[model samples]
Target: MVYRDYNISIVVTIFISLGLSIININTINSILIFGQNNVLSDVVCEKPGIKSISASGALKSHPPKNVIDGNQNTRWSVSGIDSWVQVDFGEKRNICEIDISWYKGDQRSYSFVVEVSNDGKNFKEIQSTRSSGTTNDFENYELKDSEIRYLKIIVTKNTENNWASINDIAFNMNKEPDQNLSDPKTEPESPFIPTKGYGDNIAVAADWSCGTPAKKTVKNVIAMEPSLLVVPGDMSYDNTGDCWLDIISPINDLVRITLGNHDVDEGNPESLAKQYIDHFKLPNTYYSFDYKNIHFLMLNSETDFDVGSKQYNFVLNDLKQIEIDPNIEWIITVFHHPIYTTATKHSPNEKFRDIYHPIFDQYDVDFVIQGHVHNYQRTYPIVFNGHNPDTPIVTDQHKNTYVDPTGQIYLITGTAGRQNHELIGQANYNADQYKGFGFLNLMLSNDGKTIKGVFYSNNNGEIIDEFVVQKTGAIKPINPDRNYQDDKNDQDNLQSNPLDSLFSDILNSTPRYK
Candidate 1:
């Protein structure tokens, strides 16, 4: 049955209370509720039973059984890190989402991994993520896995204390689609038809060295299964980049990387850069690629990017050409070093900002993603301030949404589980920052008129930051005399990329992956 009223969402839980007399716990199937003005039709209200539960070791009063008792007040607590709670669902089911309410989850974040098993002996990792530190309410974690009988939650650590505790846990299974919803002849009419998601997404990160701290982050990216994977730099800090490459082998060919300071081995290049270049089959140290409607310019921060330099001229001409390209609607520049960072470990790069920022603004570069700071930060759509590089002129005042924003937005997405660098510098034009393990997922709308950027924390369902840009609308004009123009005659300063032709054949050659 379709539910049009917003209150009908309560029908999901209310269905159990309304029809418990006729329901059978032994059967797991969706009930077709007859109703008018529907939204979610053929909703599944039955959940499987928990046969048995065991924990690494539970407190005397708060036993593992408390988790299955369906009481939010009671909980199961363990001493500390690596503590686990396992459950047997008696039979296999197509699990898709898990809901968990942690003890004092509103106060602190809990880092945990979910593993599932079919046979009681072997378990496979389903998800390694954290809890939303802001809520004690049940946080729903979506999954995409086949039938599984056993489930386990391995608590890595908690931010607040040495206790790994949980108030409640539940699972949602993915049911077969309703025939009416699947058949083209029986398609229903609703608002969803027009706004359905067909947008392409690119997952980006940096400082992803192979370690326990980085494992969860890498797994999270694999689960995202983005159309493209771009790494700004600092892939493997461990001498050879093979370790990190092996971990991300599933999406190796689709990954494009920039040379970070670490990737260049602190002034010593070649070996480390070669690993990523050879492994991923990059065309050059710096090149351009077009994926869907978004054009990506891979800038090498380790090399010469100064004014009148080869790198500078390449960037100038690249932006100039992309400006006239009718097919390209969005442009993103990815590099290793952040020019506008407030992190004390690596403060802002004054020369880099003055040289490149205005150029980015000139070409209407929508977003810039950088690494090297080992944290996440984003600036409001701001134009370069010639008076003081530290202070940029804010073009759009809005925080999370933009309507054809005037200036360019810069982001430091180095939070790939490597470690958080301390932010000791002044927060002059900073918007927000997150010192956690995560990556940026930039999504282009199906209509090709909008783009959404979401910074997702590794393993946790927490979205550190989110923004939407309606590119089709008129740009909110900044100052009438605002100077974003920076022109350079680099017609002669051209380097040919055998891979990226005039039309940027990169998008055509590679089979796009989801």
Candidate 2:
């Protein structure tokens, strides 16, 4: 889509401006090389020159050929789960990008996987992603360069309906430059800096969608300038999600969200949730990441999470390994539902309290952040009781502060642009509660021993609630009553790279820092 016009006169003028003498062919080559850093400076690549386009099926007037006809009005519309659109380059060619304009893209998103092949019989999947659903124009999706003669898009499902339609599509490719620089003058580029961050402050809030509350919530979040923004759940209430996506565009790079009931899979292969995942480039619905000395475990409450289930096993094994690690100083779990809450809208789940509260106590988890009640509530560092789930063993009842806490303290900051819920009576377990639109600012101290939780109401910038959690001494497990298997640890075999294990995803794109 880009065209560059460079003439010998312009090159000579640039060379003359640089005060060059004895200009020859080699000197001219050097000047050309110096003019740009890209090796394919003179290479022209408009499209892959699609020889033919075919699809599994099409409606009456719409056909696959319309996709490559360079017309936005024409499109290929098909309806099926595994329906596909294939394109041929006539010969093997190196491709690195795909530009496509989906029909009615402004209304809904489409999910699909792209596969490429040198031979027509064997294909390799290159990327699994979705469209922005906000643009009818061409959106370029980059990929690794591979030589292929055949390419196809396998449509899974679109968000709005079962139809898969594309207005225009193009595969851009580049051939190896034939020109060689006899006298090169290109300097080495500087080391790349990461587009994301890992710093002290972590901003948290949830249940945000649209309207004035959502806009004000965004302002509050950006005001803190947090290195990381963790939204527990209930992110985009709208199925199209254009509203939330537009509002959060300012801090999309630093956001990490968990799955909520509203964000669950719809069996349209999880129509809305999958779109969110692909848009954010997340590894999965639930995952773990380490920031500085803190280990953040994001869980999916909408899916199965029983003791022997996949998510349960994941967290159990994950925490067992982190138990002995010397690097991790704090453990924070994030999810949608709450195990302990006095809010009457959504009653606390006794099963989660019985199953995970003991695990969090065992693994020395510090905080459990959740969103679902549409209000804010904080509890004292408490341990679970299977026989008596109503009254948890409140370890530290200082009300406002805990020093070297005995158990994991749970906090529900669900007041992130949603209807507020009222608590039952004066609950003894609740530390501080608020019913308003606000955000939770977890300010990590310089020594990394204390994390002060501050809830600021977005309406009047009032400090509705505040609490302090400090690890002033060694972690002492409460030895709470439990009925679960305890794995063995030799302490001698506790050898692993927590840094590499936690940060393997970002290593290729960023330098490690917090």
Candidate 3:
């Protein structure tokens, strides 16, 4: 009887050991699936088995699932205002961040608020942004220490016809294991390095948008490998700030921009301007910077430009400072509105001409680059009365090269790519004009004494217009009786004539006293 009891005790001990082993296995499986210590993967939202996605309303073909389909080409679009889309993870999950790719995201700005919920009923606001404009790129926002299963994005405002569209949504979830692992033996590719020897070449363009002919122009510009890019105005026609950012972010650090009318079209102008300021990290709307031997002044045409206005005073002081700097050989002014445009659709802005042209003439500004007319126009070296287009006194008719010009040369190159081409009818002041998509490339010599302007057509990849401006010592007299040739190679033989005495005196006199 004692032997039997000993065998039974051994069996009991074995049963208990098996039970404990089963419990431990279950615990390990739980840790692997939903443990807090798991490493999060880069693309947690793309994982299968999402609970559900719902939206306030969806257009006929665009359902809310398009946002979670991991495809940027597809989108969920709603026609009404105050639309929203929400996603549920089925179980409580730790969401650390959310990313969104906008749809039709150009030229317009979008305003939205992000909220999170634990029970899918009581939601709490986590982040609110006034204007989130970007195209074909994901804008990520971080969520701090909050564990929730439901995420909702509410669109409260938009600059584009009250439509709400989102291309894709992504999540960075905490406590998620990274399933993607490459072979340890494989080597990684090297990063891209731009070619040298083109550092001083600057590319100038405006009114560019993604997925358009301008995109090809931008690609050409990148291929040229310019050191810097100057966009005068009218960046994205859709007012989608984010879209513009996405299109230009590849060269973000190299771009210098000025404001345009389209950039400030939101309900609250201050808020809209703030979006631009924050994105570019600009000191102010109108500011100046020095690059190489060129001094660049970016003005705001939409703002007040009266003599007593802040912008006017800023320009006055900035020009004064630039004039005294001996190192600055060239003064290039950039703004949205053209002071002198020959396009018949939109005439020259009289206010800008009245308030700022005098300052430009006073400083003998080298080049004034402007947009807003949707074409390319290069004027003859002209001196104006600061209030009239008909008053443009052509100081020199030396076609492509002006040797010691008496006044600033104005260029309207708003044809980077926007709308239909403006009618390029005949204009007396316009030396050359083209109604096509193109950009101006300015090559400034190292000494800053000469600038070569070349307008390249994106459609045909040909040079449409070209000019050279050379600065010599003092102003020389001009004679109207002498005929000037349009040939670029004949510049060296051209000389100032005695008949241009009046222009010579004006050039020699201080413009501040005029």
Q: Lowest summed lDDT over 10 consecutive residues: which window, candidate 1?
A: 7-16
* TM-score of every candidate: 0.55, 0.55, 0.56
CA-lDDT, candidates in order = 0.64, 0.64, 0.61
* Residue 192 accuracy (lDDT) in model 2: 19
Q: How much is 136 displaced in model 3, in angstroms?
A: 39
lDDT of 3 at 200: 57
lDDT for model 3, please: 0.61
TM-score of 2: 0.55
- TM-score winner among the candidates? 3
- lDDT tens readout by residue for model 2, 1-514: 1111111110000001111222111000000000111231223443446678787888768777777666778878877665788888899775544666777777666666678988788999875556667866665444333567888887676655567677666454555421121123321133212134223668899877554565667766776678888998877554445667888999988888887765542122256777777787566667777887788888887767788977788788778877777878899999998888884657676677678887887788889999988688888777776567787777655556566777778889887764455566646778888777778878776377767777777645567776666665664656645321121132321233233322233223221111
Model 3's number of clashes is: 17
Q: How much is the lDDT of residue 8 in candidate 3?
A: 11
Model 3 TM-score is: 0.56
Model 3 residue 5 CA deviation (Å) reads: 96
Task: At residue 348, give the lDDT of candidate 2.
Answer: 73
